[model samples]
Every structure is written in structure tokens, then in C-alpha cells.
Target: MIVQTLPGRRAFIRENTRLQAPPHTPELSLHLADEVTPIWRLTEEALEEIGLPPPFWAFAWAGGQALARYVLDHPDIVAGRRVVDFATGSGIVAIAAMKAGARRVLATDIDVFCEAAVGLNAEANAVAVDFTDQNLLNAPPPQADVLLAGDICYERPMAEAVMAWLRRGREAGARVLIGDPGRTYFPKDGLEKLAEYQVPTTRELEDLAVKRTSVWTLP
Candidate 1:
């Protein structure tokens, strides 16, 4: 299905599909399609075996890399806590939060396709995540103990809004952490960097072999 909606002045166009988990890995290969290029495939079993779920929006460059690295490093952040995986694309961060022992996980995305993608990927990983497809601007603020966001700062206005929300979360006593790959808009002053990694990115975006990404906490 294709959806078109106007959130104020910005145009939002999304194509989405609802799918079930595959009985075997072969039936569940994640695809990455570049501009004017054929889809590249990576299987679910490959990701699961490596302790990851399908990289939902891998084509976005920084998001996927930050998510993968976050899971590998700070699974404890979500352990025994209520979590909100903001802008959850492939449900990777949500799944990782669940695996890390989050009591409950809410995966959010404004994109309609994310509704199904997150559900399928969560089921495939045997993780339970409540999916919210509502626009963040209109939705209630999440009441989770921990808030996780990855690669949401590429765009200026979105980044600014997200930063404001995160600041509010911090003020409300929720632990707010973000995984960002040095995007131009990431707030630099109040955040304490936790971990850094070299991430996979595309040629169209940047020229680094691995982009430098970090997990930062708002102080």
C-alpha cells in the first residue's frame, strides 16, 4: 500500500507491506536497494545468528550501522526497563532492547511501512514490541524508563524536534540515549559520549570506510 499524508507542509509518502516470519532463514532475506541498483540481500538467519535482526532501513546509511553497534555494546541499557525505540525502522533497536531485557518495548515510526516491518521483524526475533505508527508530533510522550533513538538527526528540523523531545524526557527523569553517526545536527553540549564505533555507510553520503558513531547520554 502507498500512503500520502500532509503533516503541516511536508509531504510524506510511504509504501508498506505486512509480512509474516519465515519458517526458515531463506524466506526472510533483508534487501537493500541503492539508487539505480538491484537489491542486495542479507538473510534473517544470518542476522539472528550474529545476534541482530534485519536492518530495516539499512539504505539510510547511518541508522543501520548505529543500531547494530548499539545492540552489540549496550544491551544493558534496556535491561529490566521499559523502553521506547523512537523512529524504529526495522525494529532492530526494539528487538535489541527486548533481548537486553526490557520489560516492555514500544517501537515507533511515522512511516506506515514500519508498522508491518517492525511487527514481522519483532516476531522473527521472538521479541514482543508494541508498534505505534502515529506521528510523533501528535502523539503522547512515551513514559518509558529508557528512550532509545538511532540515526534520527540527518535532517535539521526533525533533529531539532527530536532533541527537544529528548530534553523533555531527560527533564521528566527518563534516561535518554541516542546513537548518532556525527550528523550535522546532533546537539554537542549537554551529551556525554558513551561508546563510539566505525559504521558502514554508502558512497553517496560520506567517504569514510566506517563512519564514527557514538552512544551519548544527555547530562
Candidate 2:
């Protein structure tokens, strides 16, 4: 508790978690918490003592897993392009883009701890991925050839905000891709399904142990 610095937060992550491959994306490995409940409970309690939010950076969610798998399979989507992974938790999709031979990859998240997590995961995967702690929600979409977002539609407001920003990215001529595990706020219209996967996840993270996640592009 009380992790005030980036190093302190990184150390807490390293101590509480282990480097392992997510079940749905075995090609890449990340430093992740072992059980969802322990870290969830700890972060919940630490909210008062540490002023840290829930450790979303510690788990590979179903949407990220399926998106990573899709990227690895469809290298042409990112090959030689500047890619941005928005709301990158655990940096799974950004790492996958790098491994798929992207010219560059930038992973962005609101949590500063995610910078450390993304850096560690990039090093482990032998891919160079840049990280940013800025929220980038209200700002203009940064220049990129492609934008990847996974599991971003969990809440109504967040889903609406990011969708609008992502649409701006698409209008600016960047291909925007979203991965969702049937989140309620996902705009069912105007998205072309690029790929789908049966992503295995812990029940602690979702209602089902196996989630059918899909990758969609605005076209």
C-alpha cells in the first residue's frame, strides 16, 4: 500500500504477480497477478491507504487476449504501420502489434503504473513499445496508421467517450479497431467484424469463464 512513485508501484506489481502467458494468448507473456480476487481486494483496500485504483494493468482481459491473437494471425493489419493501443492494459495488444512487425507501437493508459507494466511486458516479449500515462480521452487522436482498443466498452460513459474519440481517429484516415466481449455499450451498428475468438478468462473478471470476444473495424 501507499505506492507513491512509479518504481514503488512497479515493485508492488512484480512482488504480487508473476511472469506468465495468458491462457488465450500463449505467444506472449506478461507480469500478471496470479489470482484476480487477491489483487482486486488489495487494490480495493489500498484505495484509501495507497490512493491507487484497481490494478487493471495486472490482468489480460478477454478482449485483449482475442485481439492479440488476431493481430498475431493477421500481421498484415499492422505490418510496417504506426499503431496505437488505446487504454492498453498489460500492453498485450501493443506488444502483439510489435511482434507482428509494426513500424512503431505506442501504448496509452490513464494509470501511470501501466507505463511500467507495458515496459516490462515489451521487454519480456522482446518488442519495443512506447507508453504514455495521459488519458487522451478529451484530446485529439494522435497521428497513427492504426488504433487498437480492447475491452474499452465496459461502462456506458466511458464507452461513449472512447467511441467518439475513436470515430474521430477513423475520420482522420486511421483505421480503428475495437475488441469487445459483448459489452452492453458497444455500438452494434457500423462496425465490421474482423475476427472472433473464444477467449478463456477467469470468472472473477467476467460472468463466464470462456468469453467470445470479437475484433471490429469502423468502415
State the lDDT of candidate 2 residue by residue for 25-140, as single tens digits: 89899999877778867655644456455678999999899888989998999999999999998999999999999999999998757888898889899989988888898799
Instruction: State each candidate's clash count.
Output: 0, 0
Measured with C-alpha atoms, the lDDT of residue 123 in candidate 1 is 62
Candidate 2 stretches with Cα past 4 Å from truth are 44-53
**Candidate 1: residue pairs that collide:** none
Which one wins on TM-score? 2
What TM-score should be assigned to candidate 2? 0.94
Those runs of model 1 whose alpha carbons end farther than 4 Å from true positions after fitting are 1-61, 204-207
Best by lDDT: 2
Across residues 1-219, which tens digit of lDDT does each residue of candidate 1 receive? 012222211111112222332111222322223431211122222222343333344344465446545654666777889988888876667777787678998888875446655665666667778988777655446788988888888779989998888888888889887888888888778789877767665564566756787878887
